[model samples]
Target: MNAIRQRIDTEVIPTPGPNPKNPLQARHLDHRLVHDLIARPEILGRLRALVGNDLVVWASYFFTKEPGGKEIPWHQDANYWPIEPPLNLSVWMAIDEVTTENSCVRIIPGSHRRVVPHVPARDGVAFGQEADPAYVDEDAAVDMVLRPGQFFLFNERLLHQSHRNTSSRRRMGLSARYIPPFVALLDQDAPPLFPDHACVVVSGDDTFGLNRTTNPPPRTA
Candidate 1:
């Protein structure tokens, strides 16, 4: 991670949040490996049970929260996402050991049952999107602490957040957002996050024909 952080942290005052901005566009980062890892029978097979067989990884990012980093307020992934039906699911793979003090992901139980209203987040937070902090049942928030290589998949609409890392160790999570083929990318009119956002088909086929996913470059010498 030190190498990755050094390689991608090109911005001034980079604090382990979204440096180099979006991970989806990072050349040094290997998106193919991410696709292959989630496509395996053990992972993709289980995802099919929750979503459908026709899957496409439309978005991916690395959420790096350093010790004493910014607060990740309670919010739903679907709030910012433009996908319809909100069927897209997210899988967050832990790249470092996670704990409560380190600000591991926490979720409000049963919060996925409905869409909670979201408003602009306070300044300095990543992405500037958040749900009402008071709306969440803090007592019911379940901490998803994990170690390196462990991951958790959940509904995109699930209410979740992370605290300011009070521990010395930094935390990182790789998130891949998957959705069925029928889900349309409503943000074509909006500015592209990356230079080119291509649909990476992780499982089944893209019969919908609405994707322009560019495959990762072939391995080099």
Candidate 2:
């Protein structure tokens, strides 16, 4: 924990930003940890329970929200995803102690049951898009405060968002997306939203041959 914390604190966080995309994507391909976590047997088994026995790691990302970082607007991960019927799920692994004061993730219960409309965000706030706060019972939204090394799984279409890092500590999380091979990504013929990424079959075979991938990017920068 100390080593990775120091790495993130020194190497990843404090990166020149005010960037529009999530901080995680910056190191998405640069780190071997991304692939290692996805290939984890326990993680793969759990993902199989949802999307079926066969699965592919479609995407992975890191979230390192520093103090004073902006709040992520209420939104669904599926809103930007290209998957059909949205069978995707994510495992958010905590790298640091997270809490409500430091902008931990929050989700609306049962919100995964449907897809809601999202509008473009204003003033570069949040994830560049947002769902109406009035759309859900904000009071009922659960705070996913986590201790270091803890993690949680959620559906991609689930209503979730995080707040600003008002507290003094840095908050970090790594998300790995999993889906069955039958599910396809939309808009592949055009410029893709997330580039420099490849999917890998962590467990079973990709019978549909729907994705292309490399044997994990080099770990050393």
The TM-scores of all predictions, comma-separated, are 0.82, 0.84
Question: Any runs in candidate 1 off by more than 4 Å, and if so which?
Answer: 1-31, 189-192, 216-221
Q: In candidate 1, how many Å is residue 158 off? A: 0.3
TM-score of model 1 (CA atoms): 0.82
Tell me the tens digit of each residue's lDDT in model 1 across 1-221: 34433433443123322124544333322433444545557668879998778888876666788888888888988787777666788888776778898889998879999888888898866658789776778899899988766788888779999888889988877777778888888764344344345667777888887756655434430
Model 2 lDDT per residue over 1-221, tens place:
66766776676644631123545552444555546655677777778776678877767667778899888888988887777767788888888888998888999889988788888776757577788665766887999998876788898878888888899988888777878888887643332234444666777888887766545556673
Per-candidate clashes come to 2, 1
* lDDT at residue 167 of model 1 (Cα atoms): 91
CA-RMSD of model 1: 4.4
Question: CA lDDT, every prediction?
Answer: 0.70, 0.73
Error of 2 at 150 (Å): 0.8
- What lDDT does model 1 reach? 0.70
